[model samples]
Target chain A: MLEVSREMLAKGTRAGLKTTWELAKVVVPTAMLVAVFKASGLLGSITDFFAPYMGLFGLSGEAAVVLFSGYLVNLYAAAGSIMALSLAPKEIAILAVMLTFAHSLLVELPISRKAGSPLGYVLIVRMGCSLGAGLLLGVILS
Target chain B: MTVLWEGFLQGLQGVWTVARVVIPLMIILEIAQGNGLLQKLNRLLARPFRAIGLGEEGAFPVVVAMVFGLTFGSGVILNHVREGKVSPEETKVIGTFMALAHALIEDTIIFMSLGAPLLLLILPRVMVAYLMAYLVNRRNQHLSLPEGHHIQGIN
Candidate 1:
């Protein structure tokens, strides 16, 4: 798979195209669900439920959706939610930190698989670290 | 179909924002990859990573991929791993770390519009991802798997 090699270059290009098309297909269906969720305002109550914990992380209720969704989907989906919602400076910064450490389960899983990763272990470790670090950072910042 | 239409419209919306920035930046980074640079950078990072149990060469691509945006850039990095340029162990470490957090550029930019400071989020995330990756890498090194599973790098 040496990208410098001609075959890799072509293969990589094709893969990139496949990725783009795949992303489009996946993102749309997901986004529609997200849109409905937003329209119904179910997220608000959920955000409210998580607000205190998130606030402990120095983020707002609205931001929980952004952080959680970003981890479940991709950054774009997270951004789409962030865009439609109103957040304070503290909230967005917290999100930035949360996202900085995690995003887009769809993309990372396949790559991990290709690399012969023990995915469950890796994910568990990463999740624990990300949440702990995010909380720590939030405490320090707060 | 409605979902498709809605998604289609949202996809269009992406063009004007995060995609515009992320796509260009990814190209710039790819074009900028250099063997000499990778070699030198890997050497410098080796000691730090050695302490964490990672082979030297795994440093830069994973770091850059994490610090940048994950979707596209990380995908590219994944492509490299598949090519055997990054070993399975290294890939695990990188994947573990980056999975925790990657794509700072797009995330920061997107959040900034909603009122967050780009630096505030970026700095903490990078440091945490690196630190956690190092620790996990160190922990794993103590328990060796079968040999010959190592992925070769370009340099």
Candidate 2:
């Protein structure tokens, strides 16, 4: 049992290190970009444009950045954006649920197709579930 | 220049925080996999999976994806489909559910570290994915495509 555990620990550490490296590659660069956007005041205009729609999900306009990153780029990018901002826990929770249902579309959609699911079907289901999750969580949490 | 520098520093800090959460979680997941925990989980999930139109074979990929993330999970799925262990209909159901809720542990932890509520983050996605997949399975059953219309083996 001890031997098995030691092997598990070694393997887990290796996998952990690799995964963290992958995450850092995305998170650090994206976070810096978002911070640049915030510092330069670009984020404000972007926020203003998205605020009303975001309000439907009980999130601030700034959350659009997180959602956009998660949708187009990947979840680590979304995390970077989230770190650069200050949001209430409630809004974070809402974004969390929404993104879980529909992040990383450009990559995962094709993977689904290659697994025998249609591209269009996966796309619609993901986006629909994301919006639906956001809406429902918005109502319940608010 | 100051703004850029500050941004770089903040990004590093964020990476540190996220790394603290991610690395440990990955280790725990690895240990679980080493213990054959996933097989037990697959068995536990098989019945509920069938309610959404997946079989014993289909449940493995979905469970793997739910834990590991879609990219890895889809590899198992593709292998199973190629082996004829999972049908097109089953693949569609797996895709629907996994699309909505894959990578549950890692994604949820990342959000939780950012102050998202844990239960709120997980429960809703699971519930929504199950409900949506169940609905799609029902619809697929009714539509029952003509013999040749099934997506000829995925490339």
Candidate 3:
């Protein structure tokens, strides 16, 4: 009984730390990038280019910032960007789905590549899925 | 004095709100991993993945990573890779698929909060992504891998 209890406690502590680590990846980047990107106005330029293309997938170009940024940062950063901007309901949903399949290629790639799977194919699949899902939904609803 | 205090209060409130949501999610995902339930599920799903020449046991990591954020969900996969249970080749493939998509839970919630149609948006989103990744990974595996390379990073 004592052994079981001790094991459970140790497990709980590890879980807590792991979760904290995951949350921090999101929260920290969001806190830092909020002001920087907002002030830089670069988000607008990137969105303008991606806007028409993203609209092909049922989203606004401006919303592309969240999707594109999702790859460099994590969902928290994407969420932060979403909060900063005023996205249409449909646009927000589409962007959300697009990011779901692909986020933070940089951070994840090294670890994944180290794991030794096909890097290029994964990118293609996610991008294809993102575009397909995004546009199909965009057309039907929006 | 009043404005400064007000600002401080709002900041504190914001932090607290974020903390509330993030903390619970982290804990739940952690338990999901710690209990070894994930591995059992992965082995079950591995069969379908194997039909395409990918490992069936990958199902667990892919599902978790899809539902949770990669940071939150990839621990089990990482543990396996380190233990040499998964070949490095499989890891790269899984990593790529995951990079393109993971953290389905938090993601759909964000969309829900943003006023997207959860049923229409979230459901098809996962199905399509998973399908695509599986197909692409399978098709691409026909290529000849370099010879004389021993798999690395296992214990």
- Report lDDT per candidate: 0.61, 0.86, 0.61
lDDT of 2 by residue, A24-133 (tens): 89888887888889988999999999999999999999999999999999888898888888888888888988998888889889988887778998898889888988
Q: Give every collision pair in model 1.
A: A101-B100, A101-B101, A102-B100, A102-B101, B68-B103, B69-B103, B70-B103, B87-B151
Task: Enumerate the candidates' DockQ scores in order.
Answer: 0.26, 0.66, 0.26
- Give the worst 10-residue stretch by lDDT in candidate 3 chain B: B146-155
lDDT of 2: 0.86
- Per-residue lDDT of candidate 3, residues B1-155 (tens digit): 44334433433333444555555565565566556756776776677667534566555567677665576446868777777777655665566556655766666655555565667555775556456556656645644332223333231
On TM-score, the stronger of 1 and 2 is 2
Which tens-of-lDDT digit does each residue in B92-152 have in candidate 1?
6776666655655545666665456767766766676678777667656655543224433
TM-score of each: 0.65, 0.92, 0.67
TM-score of predicted structure 1, chain A:
0.69
Model 3: lDDT of residue A21: 59
Root-mean-square deviation (CA) per prediction: 7.9, 4.2, 6.9
Best by DockQ: 2
